[model samples]
Target: MKFTRNASANWKGTGMDGKGTINTESKILNDAQLSFKTRFADGVGTNPEELIAAAHSGCFTMQLSFILTEAGFVPENLDTKAKLAFEDGTITTIHLDLEAAVPGLEDTQFQELAQKAKAICPVSKLLNAEITLTATLLS
Candidate 1:
């Protein structure tokens, strides 16, 4: 299966003066070259890092959910946060934290699922940057 989203930006003037529209629909814009990617965060005007976070978080969560299901457990809720760090003008790493409510899940099983999710998530595989994960199985 394939998934996609498109973005376009128009900039004029200079930093702090030039503003660009992203997707040209959300009306979320970037100005002052603030480095706002102009896509889905900070009022839906997202940046590349935000997009990475979105992809990573969603993929990892789904992977973990599937792993849990395969392991014979049902999760009440599964939430993950992905943080992308960019420094020296390059993305360094993506850190993921997950909180899952699975009544009968053992801690070890949860860790295993998290590891598998990190290893096999499509985003993780596609990214060359390091991906770190932490998970908690909440009762």
Candidate 2:
């Protein structure tokens, strides 16, 4: 499967003083505010890092869901959180914390499938950083 998705950003003025709005093709984030304050400080809006984290977490969870179904395990719930670390103008690491509830799924198999999803997810492949995962199977 091949497809394309895009988002646009508009900015005005200097780096620290400038403000911007981001629009996505899906309209889920239409005209969302973004700025230096939002990125570096606590401001009312979203930033690149936050968006990346969202994308990574969503992608990883979905990928794991597919893998689990293929392995004959039905997932009751999969909650994933992606934490990105940015320092010195670089994204250094992304940590994925996953809590999963799946009936009849063994811990060893769950760990292997979670690791596989983390390795092969499109967003994980797109990023150039140290990726780590901690998967906990909930009984």
Candidate 3:
């Protein structure tokens, strides 16, 4: 199977003063605003790092779900939070916090699966930064 996705960005003016818009193939983001303030400071728009974090979180969680099912466990709930650190004009780290509930699953097994998911997930593989994961099994 193959999948293709596309997103476009347009910018006007200088780096700090320029304004940009981001549009994706899925249309979930249509002309989303992106500016220097948004990327550096607390601005009124979304930034690339924020979007990358969202993608990492979503992809990791979904991969974990599939891994659990394949291992004969059913995931009742899964919540993953991804944090991206951008410093010195480069992405430095990506951290993932995952909390999941799976009935009758051992901590050891869950931990192994979570780690595997973090290693094998497409987004995790694509990112060229330090990746850390904290997995908690909910009671």
Candidate 4:
């Protein structure tokens, strides 16, 4: 399947002093503010890295759920936390911490499926950085 998603950003002034607003086609992030301080320091706005983290976590979790379902295991819950490391103006790595409760799924099988999901997720394929995953199977 081929599809397109859209998001736009409008900025003004210099890099450090400039400010921008990000808007998505779905309007989930309508007029969200972004600034240098927001990216570098602790500011009251969202940054690209944070957004990437959110997207990666959501994508990876969904992919895992699909894999689990296909493997005949119904997941009671899946929680993923994606941590992105950015340095030297480049994305260095993304780490995914996943805790899942899947009925009748073995730990080894869960780990294997989680690895497959990390490798095949759309966002993971799009990124040019190292991706790591730590998966915990809960009873």
Listed per model in order, the count of residue pairs whose N, CA or C atoms clash below 3 Å is 6, 0, 0, 0
Model 1 misplaced regions, further than 4 Å:
1-17, 24-44
| Tens digits of per-residue lDDT for model 4, 7-43 | 9999999999999999999999999999999999999
Q: How accurate is candidate 3 locally (lDDT)?
A: 0.96
lDDT of 3 by residue, 18-116 (tens): 999999998999999999999999888899999999999999999999999999999999999999999998999999999999999999999999999
Alpha-carbon RMSD to native, per candidate? 4.6, 0.5, 0.7, 0.6
Which of candidates 1 and 3 reaches a greater lDDT? 3
Total backbone collisions, model 3: 0
TM-score of each: 0.76, 0.99, 0.98, 0.98
- lDDT tens digits, residues 12-129, model 1? 6664444554453343432313233343225334466776798799999998888888989888999999989888778899999898999888899789888998999988999989
Worst 10 residues of 1 by lDDT: 32-41
Candidate 3 residue spans exceeding 4 A from truth:
none
Q: Predictions ranked by lDDT, top down?
A: 2, 3, 4, 1
- Whole-model lDDT, model 1: 0.77
Q: For model 2, how does the per-residue alpha-carbon lDDT over 107-128 read when each residue is reduced to its tens digit?
A: 9999999999999999999999
Residue 55 in model 1: lDDT: 77
Candidate 2 residue pairs in clash (backbone atoms < 3 Å): none
